[model samples]
Target: MKKITVLAGDGIGPEIMASAIAVLQATASNYEQNFQFNNQLFGGAGIEASGRALPEATLQACYDADAILLGAIGGAIGSPWEKAKQTPEQGLLALRKALNLFANIRPICVPDALLPLSPVKEAIVKGTDFIVVRELTSGIYFGEPRQLQETKAYDTCRYTETEIARIAHKAFQLAQTRRKKVTSVDKANVLATSKLWRKVVTDVAKDYPDCTLEHQLVDSCAMRIVQQPTDFDVIVTENLFGDILSDEASVLPGTLGVLPSASHSENGVSLYEPIHGSAPDIAGKNCANPASMILSAALMLRQSFQEEKMAQSIEDAVFAVMNEGVVTPDLGGNAKTDEFTAAVIKKMQS
Candidate 1:
């Protein structure tokens, strides 16, 4: 039996996660796979229950489980926790650190059905499928020597050779399994940290002779992403760059509501989340899109449990549903959250 931790966070989290759990349960039964789920609290909900965003019990649950499926986190509703107190976001960072989940993967693809919805031309957006491999644990996000000077604010942008090498290794390995091409994004023209990033990634490329590697200044890469998104196979970059780029790349699919993310550690602990945030404005409305959450569950199956076929099944079902024009309002469809989710689950079971 595979044990998984379920953290249904604030806002529309619980509602969407309920649908995912139903699908997972149905899939497990249909496929004859034994699966166990443990519910735990994290984020603002955790803060209310335990006075901490990431309670010891939740961390322990994550450590004990094979993988984690998180809905969304954070909301101004009924929470006095300040950002400086290591709020909901910190819980995510701490969990990533605790699990050594150094690699963050966000795959952005233009589903054919949604091509008309994309801001870019139909021809340019038709077949764009690429993955962004973001180094989660290091880079400027966790860089030391950061402090506020009396007159100026300062934060370091540091990357050790080892840090770059590890994430580079993962990117290369992924490239081998993917399109055999890797684009290392950095600002080598300006920042010293990016200089190191370019240098280390270049050196690491030598080991993957089967993979083709290129370096792009972060600025140019951003432009090319919109202009020629299909040209990219896999993009690897630092935390801050990835955070920005991933959000930008999400538009290729025509709906941020359909994107999913996975954070994986070396020891097999993984966290799956939708690329979209908690849309408090639409909370409890039964109209928020659930595709991203469902896709995140697919990622959990693939990365954490090593159930590739099951993961693919879920993904294939999603594509089938979308192709049939059954999607949520955000994708220009009339289906409610439950209706859309039910369509995906029906396709999964069939």
Candidate 2:
């Protein structure tokens, strides 16, 4: 049996998680697969229940599981936790660190039906399919000596050759399977860290002689993503740039509600979650879109379980439902969250 740690975090987390789980259960049942799902509290739920955002029990549960499914985290922008010494996001960061989930992968694909919904013109977004392999554990977010003072507060952006090589290898391997092209995005002209990034990635590329490599400044990469998104196949970047660019690329699919993310370590342990955060306003309303969460489960099936057929089944079901206009409020449809999820499950079962 495949073990999964289910963390239904905060806000609309429970709602979307319930939907995603329903679909996951359906997939397992139909495919004669066994999934042992262990539910654990995390994020704001953890704080409220035990005064800790990532309780020890929760961490232990995740450690024992083969994979993790996260709904969402955080609460309202100016809520109590935001002002507290410990915030909901700390739990997520801590979880990633403890799990050693150094590689974050986000796929961006624009469906034909949602072409009109994207901010970019249909011509640019059409046939746009690329995956961003982000170096998650290091870079500015985790760099040491970050300090705040009266006037000269500063944060460091640092990376090692080892960090750059691993993620670059991952990106290249992924590219070899797809378009045989990997675009390494960095500000090599300015940032010293980015210069090291470019150098290490170039060295890694030599090993993957079958894969083509190109270097682009993060600024131009950002512009090209909107202008000619289809030109990219696989993009590998550092943490801060990936964090920003993934969110930007997600919109090309028409909504952030449709984007899922997977963070993995060198080992098999990985965490899956929708890119969109917890929507406190829609908590318990049954109006939030569950597509991203459902898709995250699809990612887990493919990456962790190695059940490519089951993963494709989930993806096809999602696409079928969306094509039929069976979506929640965020997708400009009247169907409730559960209703939309039910449609996807039905499609998968059929």
lDDT of 2 by residue, 1-350 (tens): 99999999999899989998898887787777899899999998888887888999999999999899999999997878775445789888889989999999999988776776677888789999999998888888888889989988888888999989999999999999999999999999999999999999999999999999999999989988988999999999999899899988877887888999999998858999988899887888899889899999999999998989999999888888888888777767799998899899888777
For candidate 2, the per-residue lDDT at 158 reads 85
> Highest TM-score among the candidates is held by which one?
2
Error of 1 at 76 (Å): 4.8
TM-score attained by model 1: 0.95
Off by over 4 Å in 2: 150-152
- Candidate models: Cα lDDT each: 0.86, 0.89
Off by over 4 Å in 1: 76-79, 148-152
Model 2 per-residue lDDT at 259? 92
How far residue 149's Cα lies from its native spot in candidate 2, in Å, is 3.6
**TM-score of every prediction relative to native:** 0.95, 0.96
- The lowest-lDDT stretch of 10 consecutive residues in candidate 1 is 76-85
Best of the candidates, lDDT: 2
Judged by whole-model lDDT over C-alpha atoms, candidate 1 comes out at 0.86
